[model samples]
Target: MRRLMSIVAILAVCGVIVSSVSLQHHYATSKTEYCDLGETFNCDIVNRSEYSSILGIPVALIGMLGYAAVAGLATVYRERRDTPALLLGGALAGFAFALYLTYIEGRVLGAWCILCLSSLALITSITPLSFVVWVRSRD
Candidate 1:
């Protein structure tokens, strides 16, 4: 269980880093070479879009907070029996939100941000790992 939690913590940290990069992209004024991968996959278009923020707060910031919460649960609260459930629940919620953003990028924005996709992958991986941890803890 400890090893599994450690893995979750590491994945969450990666998520934070990815979200930080996306947040930076969200605020950048000028385009960068790495952010633009032609018209189909442009981080600038997705990051600068009106959908990037919610209630004046950047979504990337929310991702950072969410990942931090997961990390904290996996580390500080690992001894607690309820930590498994908490971690699983948090990962599930994060994954769902990431899916919604992916929908927006594909249907509304028509552009995909690599950072956002990276975050999604991180969260997707975390969700199943968390579920496995939770199940193992139950036995």
Candidate 2:
């Protein structure tokens, strides 16, 4: 369990970093060369779009908080029996939101953010690993 939680914590930290970059992009007044691909793959376009926020709050900020919660649960609360369930539940919710954002990028926005894709990958891995940890804890 410690090993699994360690991995989860590491991945969550990476997610935080990715989300921080996205948040920066969300507020950036100028285009960044690194994430500025062509039209179909422009981070600036996707990050600045109307869908980038919810109820006037930046989605990237929400993502940072979510990842931080997962990391905290994996590390600070790992000793608790309920931590596994909590990790699984949080992973599922993050995964679902990531999927929704992905759909918005591909379908509605017609643009993609590399940092967003990286975040999606991180959450995707975290979800399955969290499930495995939950299953093992159940046994």
Candidate 3:
């Protein structure tokens, strides 16, 4: 179970890293057609929107750091039992943030970024798995 949880966490981390990098690329680019699939789906519109950043930092960069922290916590959980709790907490926070971003994309921006949706999916999956891992560790 522990191995499975670790593998899942690692995979989620990879997904987040890929999505974050792609989002960062889109954010840095001026071309709006990179991920513009249609009227409802457009990465450029979402990434370039005012909601894409928090204060002065890009949200994708924050996601990369958050996912990296989750990965690190999962990797070190074996040596430190309390790391599972931290991993679960981090995953939960990331999941919550992803939800907020999704809401912004849907309600405010009226556009969707594939990379952002993928990161949301990854974080959604990570949250449950992290919870399970933390619960099992407590047993």
Candidate 4:
């Protein structure tokens, strides 16, 4: 079970890394049509919106750091079982933030970024896996 959890965590980390990198690229280039699939789905519109940043820092960058921290904590969890609490907490926080971003994309921007949605999925998956890890660790 521990091995399985580690593998799941690693896969989640990779998924988040890929999504974060893609978002970062979108943020840097400001190429709206890069991931624009249609009128309702546009990466450029969402990434360039005012909600894309917080207090001067790009949200994508913050996501990258958060994912990286989760990865690091997962890696160390093998040595410290109690680390699952931190992992679960971090995953929950990321999940909440992702939900907020989704809301902003749907309600405010009226557009969707593929990369952001992908990150949301990754973090959403991580939350449950981390919860399981935390539960198993308590045993």
Best by lDDT: 2
Residues 75-115, candidate 1: write the lDDT tens digits. 99999989999999999999999999999999999998899
Q: Name the runs in model 4 displaced over 4 angstroms.
A: 30-34
Span of 10 residues, lowest total lDDT, candidate 1: 26-35
- After superposition, the stretches of candidate 2 with alpha carbons farther than 4 Å from their true spots are none
Query: TM-score for all predictions?
Result: 0.97, 0.98, 0.89, 0.88
lDDT of all the models against the reference? 0.94, 0.96, 0.80, 0.80
Better of 3 and 4 by TM-score: 3
- Could you give candidate 4's per-residue lDDT for residues 101-136 as a string of tens digits? 999999988998888888888888888888888888
Native-to-model Cα distance after best TM-score fit, residue 107 in candidate 2, in Å? 0.3
Off by over 4 Å in 3: 32-34
* Error at 1, model 1, angstroms: 1.1
lDDT of 3 by residue, 51-137 (tens): 877997888888888888887777655558688788788888999999999999999989998888888888888888888888888
The order of the candidates by TM-score, greatest first, is: 2, 1, 3, 4
In candidate 4, position 74 carries an lDDT of: 75
TM-score of 3: 0.89
- RMSD to true structure for each model, in Å: 0.8, 0.6, 1.8, 1.9
RMSD of 4: 1.9
Candidate 1 C-alpha error for residue 37, in Å? 0.5
Best by TM-score: 2
Model 4 clash count equals 0
Worst 10 residues of 3 by lDDT: 25-34
